[model samples]
Target: MSQRRQLPMPRPRELLTNSSHFFAFGFGSGFAPKAPGTVGTLVAIPVYWLIADWSLPLYALWLVVTFALGVYWCERSSKALGLHDHPGIVWDEMVGYWLTMLLAPPGWQWMLAGFVLFRLFDIAKPWPVSLADRKIHGGLGIMIDDILAAVYAWLAMQLLAYFFVG
Candidate 1:
């Protein structure tokens, strides 16, 4: 068996010095020693609460702007750390969780459902999400798979709300 190359993890000073690295790491949630993506998604809950009451247009605009910025942040952080889609770069997970909650019902139950669904899709990476993960490269590649997973989770959230939350 061939030995796989190991990428160097970013040092704390590096994260402290770089805004891109800090954000891409989900404000340090990505520093979790295990399941950083899940930790990052958990960090996003408060952010979602802060914006959940905004008008739909405003929320949509935030999503667009944040996603675009996440691309840049992830790219810069990945380059600094010399890795593509580093597990610690979880800005994508934060954004994907926000996307999953779009137009979701106002309740902790719904929020929990969105979280579970988003994590499921993100972890499973079904269909197009898996395809993107396999074929895409760089920051866009790192982000696109999560975006696809979010779409799947969003749809599932909608369906669940229609059936149960109504």
Candidate 2:
């Protein structure tokens, strides 16, 4: 059997000194010993709440800006950490969950649904998501898979809203 290589985890001091690492780590939520991705996604919730009332155009624009910035943040952090797509680099998860919440209904239940769905797709990595994760490299590589997963989750969220919230 082949041995699996373990990726290095950054220390808290690194986060304090590096802006890119701080953001890429989801405001330090990625430092969690267990399920850093989940913790990062949770960090997105309050962010979503802060902007939940924005107009659609504004919300979409914010996603575009953040997504672009995330690419750079992840790339720089990955380089600094001497790893590719380190588990602690979770800016992708934050952006993915926000994408999944696009046009989501206003309610705690809907938010929770979006959260669960985003996490499901992110973790499952079905089809193109898995393909991207395996084939792509660099910061875009790290973010692309999660974005694809978010698309899947977004589609599921729309379907669920249509069928149940009608």
Candidate 3:
């Protein structure tokens, strides 16, 4: 019997050099096999918690910096990997989730809602979100849906917080 040849396993990491690279790989959360976007979004929670006390403006600053830079890094990493919007690319999840978390109660209940809502909008890509997903390409495509999802989640949170909490 002839011996079978085995292919080497692919490394989990995609080398990230700059802000774009970091966002492209979901800050390396893309390496996870299962629930990559969720994992990537989850990874962002602690960072959010750390800056939990900072002014909203500060967080906003960070968000802008990442969003502006991500357009290029995400595209580069996705192209290099030979896949467009690969599951491994979860940087969009991280930023999107963070944006969703913004303006929420920050408690378990609200945070959990935010998480679910963000995921749903992200996966479904309703309305303009779908447009962004299909019409856009490269990093913009990878991140735009998540951005819309975040916007949806944030608005939903506002409504919920007002009606449910008050």
Candidate 4:
């Protein structure tokens, strides 16, 4: 049996006090005892709801900004934690989920599907995602795989939306 080694836990005080840590941890959702990535993505749902109605251009702008900043914060947090791609560094998850929902037809059903597909692709790390995860390093490494997973999930959701909901 393969056992995953846990990353050292960051204290709530440190996470809350440091802006980089706060964002890297997904506004504290990464503090969850289990599945911090899932929690972080879950935390993104409400934020998505708030902005889902915005024009596509605006949403794309937000995504770009978040991702560009993520590279920095993820790197900082990973350095502080002394772990690369720490499970607790889940800003990638939050952004990835948002990317998955971009331009998606509005509905609770589509949201749920996007969530599931995003988590699946993120965890599964198929093909290019796996390659990026294994070969890349630092914050870009951490964020790229999830972004690719988001792409996969987005495409899958689009297909499913077309076939099942069209």
Query: Of models 2 and 3, which has the larger lDDT?
Result: 2
Q: Residues 81-153, candidate 1, lDDT per residue (tens digit)?
A: 8889999899999999999999999988888888999999999999999999999988898889999999999
- TM-score of candidate 3 relative to the true fold: 0.84
lDDT of 4 at 38: 97
Ranking by lDDT: 2, 4, 1, 3
lDDT of each: 0.91, 0.93, 0.76, 0.92
The superposed Cα distance between candidate 3 and the true structure at residue 118, in angstroms, equals: 0.3
Off by over 4 Å in 2: 1-6
Off by over 4 Å in 3: 1-22
Question: What TM-score goes with each of the models?
Answer: 0.94, 0.94, 0.84, 0.94
- For model 3, residues 53-140, the per-residue Cα lDDT tens digits are 6688988888887777777777887777666777777888878888887767757777678788888888888999999988888888
Q: For residues 72-147, write the lDDT of model 4, one tens digit per residue.
A: 9999999988989888899999999999999888889888988999999999999999999999999899899999
Model 3 whole-model lDDT (C-alpha atoms): 0.76
Query: What is the TM-score of candidate 4?
Result: 0.94
User: Considering TM-score, which of the candidate structures 3 and 4 is the better prediction for this target?
Assistant: 4
Q: Give the TM-score of candidate 1.
A: 0.94
Error of 4 at 47 (Å): 0.7
